[model samples]
Target chain A: MNHPPTTATLLALLATLACNVDRKQDDVPATDPPTPHVALLTSGPVSDAGWHAGAYEGLQLIGDSLGFEVSHQQTRTPAEFDEAFISYAEDGYGLIFGHGFEYQDAASRAGEQYPDVTFVVSGGSRPSANVVPLLFHLNEASYLAGMAAGAVTAAGIVGMVGGVEIPTAKGTFVAFEAGVKAVRADAAVLETFTGDWYDPSAAKEAAAAQLRQGADVLIHNLDAASFGFFQAVREAREGGSEAWAFGMNRDQNDVAPDVIVGSAVINIPAMFLRTATAWRDGTLGGVAEYAGLRVGAVEFVPNPAQEGVIPPEALARIDEARQAIIAGELEVPRIEYLEPEDDDPPSP
Target chain B: MNRTLTPVLTATAALAATLAVAAALLALGGHSPGAVFAALLRGAFGTWDRFFSFTLVRATPLLLTGLAVALAFKARVWNIGAEGQLHAGALAGVAVAILLPVHSPLLVLPATLAAAAAAGALWAAVPAAMKTRMGVGEVITTLLMNFVAVFLAQFLVQGPLQEPRGVFNQTDEIPLAARLPALLPDTRLHLGFLLGIVIAVALWLYLTRTPGGFRLRAVGASPRAAEVSGRFRAGPVVWLAFLTSGAIAGLAGWIQVAGVTHRMYEGLSPGWGYTAIAVALLARLNPLAVVVTAIVFGALSAGGGAMQREAGVPEVWVRGIEALVILAVLTVDRSWQVLAGGGSRD
Candidate 1:
């Protein structure tokens, strides 16, 4: 913006350098804006307004506070993953957050290729020499959400709907079921995989199926599908039945204001800043590290506006479970599928 | 000179005007339109490899779908179900690849390809039959069938065809034996590109030289006049045209799956069917011309991401440029039609 007239002026300079004789028409290098050189490549756009939004918000926060240049490239396929990384690296970007688990393989190759730059993948497994997997131990929060869901279910029947069955995604569900069992011995917990990250319709169908089977409380481990789960409970309550819903990934009680009881909140921006600062300090890579309950990175946020919906005894149990997990007494279930560990032994 | 320059100049002016409007919109929104354009060009053609890679990758499906639309349009038959037909082809190709026990690429490749083409032909035949026998609109029937094709792919991926271990809504990767060999070492361009070229050349010869193709063109020009001549049956020619067009588009989808993604996911197409309509029309339904047009569009899409990455433009704005290009072409077509119609009327 400060250099619009300088574009035409640069054309004049290029002409002057060519020699004073025949005035020639050069292909005008006059088409684009002068932008600083920092870029990030992601597998999907944040326009999705849900799972990807919190990550985008963290990126924006970095832009505002850190005074660093920022740009995002949305890729559609796994094939483009490496290409996007190479593109950002070749363009001389300082830091890049790959924003998804799919970027692990590409980030490894990129880390080796562009050793000068730092690369981060949101839920990646093995951090190469230059790449770091900023693993958010949301299962700590998920365990708390399960306590809430378990406490509210009078029928002893609660349901969990998950969006892709990846290990990181599955960890939340595994921990949630564990938390439910700890609270109540004879509870019936049904889990379903809608098999999509953004299918609201499928999520709604899974919610309805759970509801029909007499599930009064529901928790969703979905990205965009949480809307459908919340809608199912809201619709149920409208039809004169008492129903409660819980959220995942980010604090999503705001999504369905009246219907949501609480959300398992993960402070992505805190993790992002910590990871970036660690990378700057030369202490970021090697081994898959995690930020759990200790760093206040992951926690459950109950809707303060609606306190009576979740029984006080249940909240107390949730608090107890949270304390137990933080104190290292409860080993939250997680899918260990990724490595620099040569063997990918089958999970039970 | 008059004929060539007239159309070219008309196209260029129309494109420039639409791009100007698009730029103004971007600028008014407080974004750098110039940066977006530069990033697009740099992303698409910044280097020799990038240009060729974008052109080749984008051209693969466009080549097949362009041929499909051109073939049917030549016979004056509207087969608007290439999208659906393509999915049907992918469904068969994926099924055959996953089910077949054969190890060698030589055997599995041809079998899967044949299955895909046959499935596409079968999908197209339903609408072709309706149009020929029941006097139904092929456009509506083909359009309606796309949902069935899309949802059928979804259902199979989620239910019976699902990879039992993974709970994601995606199919198992096709066997390595069914995959196409890459055309280039670094780029994703595959054997389908060469095949697309060969098919385009064959179509060009058939449309211009062969008696059957001439009759189809005659029908397209004036179906009533072709009937009055009493030399050929428009019904069978139209039916065959529709089915074959669908089969080619289906082949396109199958190749995209095996050659590129290696797995099937929903939204496999970012509206490749509709993109084929533009590809066919821009070349004036000429098979040879379609090659160039498809590459241009491929550049636009392939370059769009670069705009987002390097230039800081949003995906929506990158898509706006594509819409502008299409609108420019359409406006040119409409003006040409109006001018020609007006002159003939006079």
Candidate 2:
């Protein structure tokens, strides 16, 4: 809006000048430069207790462990992606971590321009020399969550609501299906993609659809949409049903603790600490890092509160499944639309 | 009769007053206002590439959005749905680009653009229908429809039209054949900017020299006066204006999609519809003038990222600066209008 248009430009201009000078200072070759700063960018609010919140936690960990001066901002557009990266690069920040794959292209371009600066995009393709795609291998935990869900579901039906069709997210769902069938050969699994990470309405609708289809246990990979899926579970249980929901992406049991049986969680803070350590020691660049369960990146925790809700045999089966997965004797089936052949449930 | 001096002088006086207030606020915060202004100038126009790319790229959406609002306002219609219209247009463009074997950039690009315009126009027609046929106030209806449109876009990408494998809810990258070539060889600025200027000029000519344009203005001034002239129906004129605005706004959406994003996402616009209101009003609903004001808004937006990157300032500060500027511009503009008393000021 050109609302008092002149006043805004002039004021913004003043700040822009102070910033650009810092950029120029960063560009000059010096024997010693100041300690490098890092910036974190997220597409959604940090309080959502899922995708964004996990990323924010990683950022905070980086600050605490590495002592890197950090900055963060929530962005609302693809255009802001380029702007934020360029600004960080020009200002001579040593590294910038964009917390989503959506920032891959922007980070790639900015990385090319700023050679001294390293750019990391979580869940993005490795696009350039200084850009590294840091992906989470969540199948390890999803498989674990699937075991818990399979044991607890009385009707032998489990549901999944996925957000968007990305490879990593698909991989987790695939492994999860394997876990479900590991306990019961005839277990029926239903999966639907809501095509968005943040649409609560669509997520709720998908959850309701699965419930009506007789799936007593539900899980979702959507970021903000997790709220809706959990809400549906809470309502179903509150209305005198024995249904449950598993939280995905982050540990969100606190979001609906009473009905949440367990959560498939990614240790994002650990990942960030590892990456920052690598960058600080100059051992990171050019390659994509895939962190899975063995490296302490993914895990599944059975809800202590829901321990008595399952029968002794079911609980025993879950324990067996967990041991097999941990001991490398079980391979969870992966759900990837990109690879249709990945349908066979892994042996637990 | 003496128009030139009043506009230029009043505009200058207004700018100074707003600056004083902003500077005072900055000083109170123990920050040097002068340093911030200087940084913005360097960031926005300091380097030619920055001006060519960041400033122009930001301006592209604003120019189209401003023109859309100006055209509607001139015909006595209020359009508060450009963001929704833009999303509709982008979605249509994406659907067509993905579905068809659009192999050639020349043919595919135009077809995609046309699809966007049509989608936008159709979306606009709903509110127009309510106002023209059912005696509904378009302001509320148009605003309300925006939420529905945004959620619909979200659904289409996440459910029906999602890319395979379902990790993220964004559409696939539009075919290379459907992409817009950069306006400059090296910069991110695309030809959509040139297109926006052309439309602005065309609308200016239509409003000033064409009879239909005159009738719309008459209606905007007073519908009874337009009815007495009997040259055209205010209903159709406003409907055309509303739909045309939607089409243009839709085109803006595709411009961002084709030229910048290269794909569709949830947030295709950051309240471009609302920003357009300020752009159109600042230009006094003059299409040609809107182009210039939109650019100013664009520069400010473009500078926001620079502020964070360069000065170690937070993103919140850049947003705060934008809000302050908007208030200053509105205050100065309103007071200037009162002072000018219907006089044309530069």
Candidate 3:
């Protein structure tokens, strides 16, 4: 009855509002070639204070140190990947960092469209002429941290609590187990995956289960869930049991300094800065850029408060192993996920 | 005439009030409100290219799901399982498109879409059967089904449906022949938008013209009244609404993958089904108006990104503004109804 007129009015009102709100086109002033602009896109919020936060810090570092105009967008869905990439490229962003493996496909498509703009994806697989994968070899550091865990464990049992059993997370645990065996051949090792990267309760429960099974030292490869993992170890100490934990992904030594023996950290901000600097100098190749102990982008940082938690001999062995890994003499166990480079085949 | 004029004036007042509040919030957050709004408008509709590529592309899923929700709500059927149905549709579509071994574009596309629709209908059948046969409430069943569907999708993608390489937690890209054809050249807008528009028009016609539509509406108004006066069983009409709504929603899922992503992933939907409730409500359960309301929400989404990019507003702020606008609109609509002596419908 009256609904027809009401609907008509609604449409007319929307039309008028849209027409009135047309953005003024006179804002842009003709300017000669502007400074190179850089942008970052993350599927999750940067306020997570771990993986995404590290990337955000890296973007800021590039802006502060390299003097490039930097911007960041927290994209919600896969659909937004292409939209964000195109929008930034259209707005004259010279370099854009899509900070996840999920971005590789979208980055590849956007790369083909905007060949002039370089798109970098952290933990990405595929790489094209304009798409670069920034691979973080944090397993190298995790191995050293595992050596420390092996030495510090009073029960001769160490555990690894990981978030998601993806190749990247699994690689860290594999290398850690290897490092533990290298230190204590008879040591018992345990591993558990929470199947999530952000569920704190799940991570805590996993860590608690490992501790209850006589594991004195634990290392975790989780993001936001690391807090819960550390809480389990801290709670063990409160229960009058000797427990120590290791942090992963970023330098989290201060997060739970008392219970944490050390941390396997990927210097994400530094790696981002180096990549942006290379892009600016036109030296950034389409090939995947591996950041590891050799490049000083990954390291095992000992907690200052937990001094001498790792025995002297064990610390020395960790240092030796770190050197060997950097020299390519020691190969830390890692899951090879990246597609083989097409341009340069591996020598048989 | 007075009835229509009052509601329209109330809606206009609501729009002005919401904008004023949004401006104040933006200014409080240390952003220039005019600049932020300008950036949002520019990002959503400044260019023909953006309108087609971003706005319409985003609207395609919303439009389909909105129609599904509108139709169900019109019949007073609480089909809260569109999210699950959409996922079931996507999973079925992808499974058929990838494994069917049919390379012909015509055959593969149609078969894939039909499978999706069937899967969605099947998913809704569970809740429908629970409600009709067991006399169970659909609200809880449909809502719970969403979690089950999401976890099932995650399991399939991580296990059986994983890419050949088994590195990423997603399915392999569907064949090129299965991908939706672009509706507009040089834009991300696909045939899905056209499909959605056609569906909306068809649904509008059905609701306004058909005898079956009248029965459904009569039952929706009051099942007892329909049974007494129209002498038609409300049960069959309710079943029809649920199945049809589920089928449309299922199309939305496959259309998204067939059109845009080209593959099924864990987070296939960003809660488009949940958002569809708001879309349907804002359109007053009218199928045709859902087309416009869906686009309005699409613009908000497209512009939300720009607000972050151009105005330096955080995603939280943008989301908050969106919620505020929706609340304002609904409040005004309700207040007008009450003032006109109609009271609340629900």
Chain B of candidate 3 vs. true chain B, TM:
0.95
Best by lDDT: 3
Task: List, for all models, the DockQ compared with the true complex.
Answer: 0.25, 0.26, 0.34
What value does the lDDT take at residue B345 in candidate 2?
32
List residue ranges in candidate 3 displaced over 4 A. Answer: A1-25, A29-33, A340-348, B1-15, B343-346
lDDT of each candidate versus the true structure: 0.76, 0.77, 0.86
lDDT of 3 by residue, B232-339 (tens): 888899899989999999999999999999889988999999999988887777777788778878988898888888777888888898888788879877866755
User: What's the ranking of the predictions by TM-score, best on top?
Assistant: 3, 1, 2
Name the top DockQ candidate.
3
Query: In candidate 1 chain B, what residue range of length 10 has the lowest lDDT sum?
Result: B1-10
DockQ score of candidate 3? 0.34
Q: In model 1, what lDDT does residue B64 have?
A: 91
Error of 3 at A65 (Å): 0.9
User: lDDT by residue for model 1 over A7-123, one digit each (tens)?
Assistant: 344345434433321222133333232533345566566776665777777777766766666778777765466667767776667678888776765677677778887888888
Judge the docking of candidate 2 as incorrect, acceptable, medium or high.
acceptable
- The clash number for model 3 is 0
lDDT of 1 by residue, B184-293 (tens): 77665778888888889898889889998898888888788898899987887888798889899899889888776677766677778878988887777778777767
